[model samples]
Target chain A: MASLKDRIGVIKLNQKVAKDIYKMVLQFDDMPDDIKGGQFAHVKLNDKSHILRRPFCICDYDISAKTITLCYAVVGDGTKVLSSYEVGEKLQVMLPLGNGFTPDKNVKKVVLLGGGMGSAVLPAIPTSNPELEYYTYLGFANKEKVVLEEEMAKVSKQLTVATDDGSYGKKGFVTNILAEDMAKLKPDVVFCCGPEVMYKALKKALEPFDVPIIVSLEARMGCGIGACLVCNCKVKRAGEEETYVRVCVEGPVMKLSEVVL
Target chain B: MSNLKVNIAGVEFKNPIITASGTFGFGREYDRFYNIEELGGICTKGLTIKPKLGNPPPRIAESYGGMLNSVGLQNPGVDHYLQKDDLYLAKRDVVVIANVAGSTLDDYIAIAEKINGSKSDMVELNISCPNVKEGGMAFGVLPQSVERVTSAVKKACPNKPIITKLSPNVACIADNAKAAEAGGADAISLINTLSGMAVNYKTRKPILFNNNGGMSGPCVKPVALKMVWDCYNAVKIPIIGLGGITSYTDVLEFMICGARAVQVGTYNFNNPYGARDIAKDLATYVEENNMDINDLVGTLILNK
Candidate 1:
């Protein structure tokens, strides 16, 4: 493996575009070059106490602007420290850490589903796909927790939202809405990134439908590399009941059928 | 500046800071963050006669204040390490201590003999890995076996310093340290990991595939420090202390209680730059106190 620490350069902390979430973007001259959709970057907050790096999936890769956008929730100490960075301060980041999704030629129609912070990586991919028809499905706990609705709607050919509290869009879960639109959308492939329960529920719903499916899994990660096997999830292997693979290295993305879910 | 430098047998280390084997992984990954050469030394990943693929998935699990691991001593063999010509570490300047494990006494002897002729600064006999099915902690638990392996490696690698790493899984760490000393070991490193298990309440099964694993991290510091103190009082040989040392205070506790040098393990997983931060923080502590680092060693007074 290439130890390309140089791939990440000094990215100035732009500003706190959202509460508890800083909207820092990479500005390296060489960055945004060849940065494909669905990739991730390792962000390091300049703090002595929180030493390990944190990984974030790419929200938007602007090759022209030489920037990548990432919106993360400040759930722990690392992100809490990260939120302290101001517009001029610099931080070290390792970009494009994992393998991202590539739109298949035969699979023209795609549906993107995301929930909570999982909604971060959705806008960058299917919304930007020019050749294929793509629809975005999002789920949130309530209207107050809903995010990126306008941005997603701007890019997707059709947008559907579901809130558990029945506060916005449709009542009940996102998968329920997908079940209603399964016939008209006729998506060739389904891509999902969300909470474990959300993914687990979606997995069961999509099981009967025959199509290529890809999912991004989340786990507690120390190093955004394969060396430390801290970030692993159960994956089914041929002849074997189940095996754990690193979510950081083997994937953030896996085929619906290939993964045990 | 405080004298943080320490000596094992005749070999010298610039400071009491040493990176634990397996956790540091041959010193390749962490170098990406800081200059590894600044630390005292590095105990490489546990190497066997032949390369090991390690255990299956679910090798690590987190606990309240610590973590458990069943890495199963995965590493390329002794010959492979020698063949690399230290290419991965060419640019760095640090003492490279080779950690060796074997199924039998002969296995330890063979690996020790090979490391004696290699660039490794010292030979750390792995008599205490709880994750492995056999031949690791098994060799360290029984006093007779500890003596047997220590003596075997000492006899095979007379030129190199042989530090027998002790297992906390035993009934008494002090007795194990004494056995290693009597067996002719130059030094001893303690508390490999207390045997532990974390049950998934819903599944009602153990978290690790091995059913049990070695616990390391902040959770076990007190247990490790107590073991180090006990072993330090029991044996004349230098004690290399390790167990969930994540801060300057933890390092100081190890030193004051008679650890010649300290190793940072599980904390590496929590923080990639853990070693560097601890080194800096320890140095600052040493300077702020207006005392030498050696002054901290074995200063623990056992109440009569």
Candidate 2:
């Protein structure tokens, strides 16, 4: 019912922002104006050696410039290949994919949380939902691995950065700091994106707070749309049987309580 | 003037490009990308009598020049399809092919019977899926089982043509193709994904949760062409060749290797418009060359 096509995007800027993390700015001539936070872009490399397109979260976007920023970590060959490219190279990029984060009518004060590179999914939340108040907390292994803190800070009403070994920002986990802040601020909702282990930590840290927690998920994707069943996430809603929904389609975003994790 | 039409089991197709099963879903997901009627036909995902949830993620892994998928035949039951996608596809001008899979003869027969009266123009019997743990690839590896499953499904769904899909993981794919032909299949499709695994060196565990998956993409083209050529010389029925077909030239290669028509797989994920793009490209090539598209089928001249 939704007719869209894979678009050719020009790489405007590609630069390393942190340790092993690169922020790529892609300029689409016809970028979808409806792009939101937590949605992703499936980018195909110009090389033929890799068949699957690597998916990245829409870290940020500039509507007036028709450009979107993608933040990725060079963890594997696909991302490694992506980091090698420079400006002016054109790639097949399918943007604004998957369902993005949307705050409900009553949601006002929202706490934005990120762990390490998962902070890439945060900045766009404020860009799209600018009306809501955002209190952000970001955690990285150390300062070298930290990214998007400045972009996140500019938009966030208050920004807190943490490192496990205290290389920079506050020492210890961001989840613990968020729990302390949650007690004082009492935000209406908490939105997070991070490694699975961080989610385990956040759930425990925010247990005393009675706010709805939403999260963005990650999966090994094939078709960044729902057509291929490879990118599935297990979802178990209240009183419903455990079922799988495509993370690329049903979500990169879902209610934390409903997720099987 | 060039002709792009192809006839498989007496069913006429406007073009030689069909989107392969499993990769194309029910065609709705792609309808958002392009008009479904632009292609020759559409093959639905592998279906069963009952709904299947399929394997867990990470069910997919990227390899050199291709990708591995262990989707495990996830599909809504035939009943759900008949009530939903069947009606939707029947409304379109394109040919609808329902790919049915089962773990046993009874499972095959039941699903085939259910699809017989549906809107699908043909039934693709998926005996070669390597991901399922049960009766899937079991019936595809041997000539006898291939024949047995083909004939039983044919007996149940006698009204429409049956295309027995062959797997490349078998001992002899040509023999299996012959077995399918002899069992009264009107046509056949090959080769399903090759059985393979992608391992993470750091973890020493397979990337896929299922530990194995069927591999498809441009890298599998050579193997698929050889198998298609072997099956072309072995069987008389029409063959719908597919394995790593991406561009129009790839379609020509498969046709020259004895494919009556070609199906675009994995490439659909590379670009949602991949199937339509290939079809358009092939149509342009045929028109510019001024030759019938069917004239290239089985036309390969091997080196002596």
Which stretches in model 2 have alpha-carbon errors above 4 Å?
A: none
Docking quality category of candidate 1 according to DockQ thresholds: incorrect
lDDT of 1 by residue, A1-261 (tens): 344443444455555544454556667666746565677887766643454567888888677777777778887656776776665566667767777778777988889998777888787785356577778999988886677788788778899888888988888899778867887778988888888787778877877677677888766565666555556666886687666666777888876566765
Please give, for residues A1-261, the per-residue lDDT of candidate 2 as tens digits: 667778889999899988899999999898789998999999998877888888899999989999999999999988888999989999999988998899999999999999988899999999999999999999999989999888988988899999999999999999998888777898988999999998888888888778899999999988888888888989998878999999999999998888887
| Residue B115 CA displacement from its true place in model 1, Å | 3.5
CAPRI grade of model 2: high
Query: Highest TM-score: which candidate?
Result: 2
DockQ score of each predicted structure, in the order shown: 0.17, 0.86
- Per-candidate fnat, comma-separated: 0.10, 0.89
Worst 10 residues of 1 chain A by lDDT: A1-10
Kindly report which residue stretches of model 1 are placed more than 4 angstroms away from their true locations once superposed.
A1-97, A102-121, A124-133, A137-151, A160-215, A232-245, A254-261, B76-80, B104-110, B156-159, B287-291
Please name the candidate that would achieve the greatest DockQ relative to the true structure: 2
